[model samples]
Target chain A: MIIEIVSWAAVGLILVTSTVMLIIHDWRINLGALALQYVAAFWLVTRHLPFVMGSTKLITGWMVVAALGMTRLSLSSEEDDTEPSSLLRGGWFRIILMCIVALVTAGVTTRIEAIIPGLGLPVIAGGILLIGAGVVHLGVTSEILRVIIGLLTLLTGFEILYAAVESSTLVAGLLSVISLGLGLAGSYLLLAGTSPPELENEL
Target chain B: MSAPILWIAIPFISGFIILSFLRERISPLIAGSVALILALTALIIPIDTALLLGSVSIKISPSIQFFGRSFTLTTADGTILALIYGLSAIWFFGTEASGTANRFVSLGLMIVALLTASIAVEPFLFAALLLEMAAMLVIPLLVPPYQKPGRGVVRFLIYQTLAMPFILFSGWMLAGVEASPGDINTTIQAGTMLGLGFAFLLGVFPLYNWIPMLTEESPPYVVGFLLWAFPTFTVIFGLGFLDRYTWLRTSPQLSGAIQIAGLFMVASGGIFAALQKHVGRMMGYAAIAETGLLMLAMGLQSSEMLNVTFLLIIPRGLELCVWALALSIIKPKVTSLKFNDVQGIARSYPFAVTAIILAHLSMTGFPLLAGFPPRLALWQEIAGQSLSISFWIFLGMLGLILAATRTLAVFVMANENKIWQRNESWTQLIMLGLGVIGLFTLGLFPQILQQFLVNLPALFNHLGQ
Candidate 1:
């Protein structure tokens, strides 16, 4: 009973972190929320996947966060200037979007459950919430960092749902590789976007 | 030796070696040679059969096991392997002439290997992940290092990545459908997911905004290679799905849906192509229209679909290679590829200009060009199905023809007093010259491809049968 409660709590944590990710523009806070989101996702995934396989998601997610953070640290202040002037700038609109996402997710949870039966309500709800929040995040921002974050979030949500459907070790490994590849690609794009034109031909 | 190891593993490893160690100037030649050899081997050596070479006996096995998954490359896969790597060789060989040799060859080889693996992998659902990996590899190639990535490349990544979950989810749902074939609800859901997944991957209609944007931002040669590679493999992968599932192929509504989707893409792509002032963007639209033709081919009766599709695909690669190479040769001389920027370019680079116009017309299905015969065959087939479908396709072709005419006019719009000069390098001329000759040869004798096209359908088991 306590395990069920804890899993439900993890689902709740996913909801908060993903919503925070959608609204927050600061890279550090967004990355933190993404890390926490993955932790919660890992917790839920363990209910379906083995502990080791589920942990790959958490490890890959944190490594992605680390890679992006390192890349962020290496950037000049001008290059790192995606931070909003005010915390509330468009934050409220995003909050409103999150609210709509939450309501729609609530409405669709049962139908998704009906389609992929044996996926518990909490898993379905959590997965749908992340997907909704990710889409909203992607729709709202075109910033490189933000787009990468949104894609990672969307894939995480998918991983959570897919973990229940497939348990192949090879699939798990391939998915982890994909997550890492996205991180590396994101880092490359971030650096390349900020570099001077003279340096373009060097690579 | 195993087929997968020979085709997939060797090229993959060679790509890495070339990237890590080889000089940029020599990489294209070596990579092209390797690809050509692989293509020839696939064409000549039958899998699962022993061959006596001089005194030694050799056998290439059909399948290999890795991490509990199977990758089987049978004799039926030879045509596909030959087609993919042969076309890849052409692209790689022209990279030097196109001036993308430094960035294209190694990565191009790796991308081809991954795509080949996508075709060979079992449980075929794994093909989605392989394709995603290939898409990721394309980013570095398309965007030069330390350059600001354009919205086109980013959106390309997002859209391609977005396709994975849809396809995988549909694959899982399909497992259920396979067991309970009568379950309409699950079938509908799975089919919808599959359709949406492919619509995104194939860049059908609305999802294709990134294609033209990509053309504007990246080098035309790299974009051209991508345009050729991605859709060709995806169409094959999608054909695998239809071949495996009885209901998906048999459903008339599904076929109609595919035809409608093709019609929308063709009509929209053609209209956009005609309206575009930018030559590069116009090429992108023309590609989208050609892909729509592939989809229309897929909607035909199973007996004729494979033949028409192969005929269409063979010419597409040749046409894109010529067009892209011509554009690359001209790009350095012009301010931009927009109509205004490139007006009167033919006065300087006559050969390149002529090649571009001819390639564009071929794609527009001009008579006595490579793209004409398959298009003629397609028109007759679609007309037999529904005259309205044929009419819309014809209208699309007309739009393309108009675009080609406009492009020709821009090329020739020089001052009357200007002297015609051969500004293109000898290498560029030779390459373009050969490509032009190829277009005419294929167009004049479409029967040249008959031998390979006869066996190409064998790639799909149930569909071929």
Candidate 2:
């Protein structure tokens, strides 16, 4: 019963953190939410995967957040200052969107649970919530950093669900590699995107 | 050594080595040489068969184990590996003349290697992960140093990454479908997921807006390489799906669905291409149209589907090579590649202009050009099936022709007093000339590719059987 309560709490935490990520404009708070989001994802993943294997997702997710944080730190004050104000410039609309996403997640969780029989209700709800929030995040933003974050979120949701399906060590390792690679690519784009353009013809 | 080690690992490792150790000027030469050698070796040496080299017998095994998984490159894969690497060699070699040798050659090699691995990897579902890795590698290549990533490049990454989950989930469902072939619900669900996955990967119809946007944002040469490489591999990967699933291939609705999708891309791409103000975006749309033709070839009911597909594939590489090389040469000379900026460009770079026009015409299926014969074959087959399908395809072709005509008029729009001069460097001229000659040769005598096409279908064990 305790484990069940913890799983339900983890699902609730995921819903809150993912919504925070969508509504918050502050990078630090956003990254913090993402970190907590991973913790919740790790707990849910452990329900299906072993703790040792599931921890990779946590570690990778934290590392991704760290890498992006460092990239953000390295940016010049002027470059960093270009970001929009905290609490998102049209925050109410995002909140409404999040509510809609929540409803959809609730509606789809039961169907997904029926389709993939072995998954528990909490796992299905958490995964679908993350996916719904991620897609909404992607649909609304065109920022490079946010898009990367959104992709990571969507993939995390997939990993959570897929853990219940296939558990090959190599597949797990490759997926981790891809996560790290996306983080590095995001870093590269962040750094490159901020730098001044070179004058030479890029033929 | 095994074929996977030879084709996948070596080139991949060499890419890093070249990036780190070699001088920028010599990197293309070394990389191009290595790719050419690999292609030639694949062509000359048979995998999984013993070769008597003057009484010293040697065999190149087809599969190699890695991390409890296997990557198998059998004899059936030789023609494709050769074609991919050989075409890659051409792209790499031309980088020097196009002035993108430094940034393109290394990552280009690595991208090709990863793509090859995607094809060779068994359990096949893993190919999605490998393709995603390949797509990630593309970001660095597309974005120049110190420049902001454009919406196009970001969208490209997002779309490519998005394909993974759908494909992986579909593969899981497909395994279930295989266990109980009578389950219609699972089959339909799996099929829908698979179609959505590929539509994103191939940039079919609605999802392909990034192509033109990317062309507008990046160099013509880099985008050209992507246009040629990504779709070609994705098509082959899609073919693998058809070959592996009996139910999928035999589904009565499959051919018509694929045909309709192909026609939509062709018609949309062609119509859009005709309306584009920028030549780069025009090329993007044309590529979309070409990819449509590839899909159309796969939709053919005849056993000759594979042959017609290869016929279209081989010429596309050469056509893009010529067109891109010409554009690269002309880009620095003009203010931009927009029609207004390139007005009367032929007066300054006659050779480059001519090459561009010829490549454009070839892609429009002009007679005596490389894209003509395969297009003719496609028209014949489609006409036999449905007159409306043939008519739509023809309309697409006419749109492309109108695009070419507009491009020509723009190029030659000059005061009669303006002098015609060739400004291209000898290397650029020579490469462009060779590419043009290749296009003509393939067109006038399509039989040249028959040998390669004959055995290409063997890669798909069940398709067209």
TM-score of chain A of each: 0.93, 0.92
- B316-337 per-residue lDDT for model 2 (tens digits): 9889988888898888777889
Task: Tell me how far candidate 1 lies from the true structure as C-alpha RMSD in angstroms.
Answer: 1.4
lDDT tens per residue, model 1, A1-203: 88788888987898899888877677888899889998999988888999999998899999999999999889888765656564688889989998998899899989988867898888887888888888988898888888899888888889889999898877888889899989989988888756666665664
Q: Pick by DockQ: which candidate is best? A: 1
Residue by residue across B70-164, what tens digits does model 1's lDDT show? 99999989888988999999999999999884758998999999999999998998899999999999988878775678999999999999999
Candidate 1: where is the Cα deviation over 4 Å?
A: none
DockQ-based CAPRI category assigned to the predicted complex of candidate 2: medium
Highest lDDT against the true fold, candidate = 1
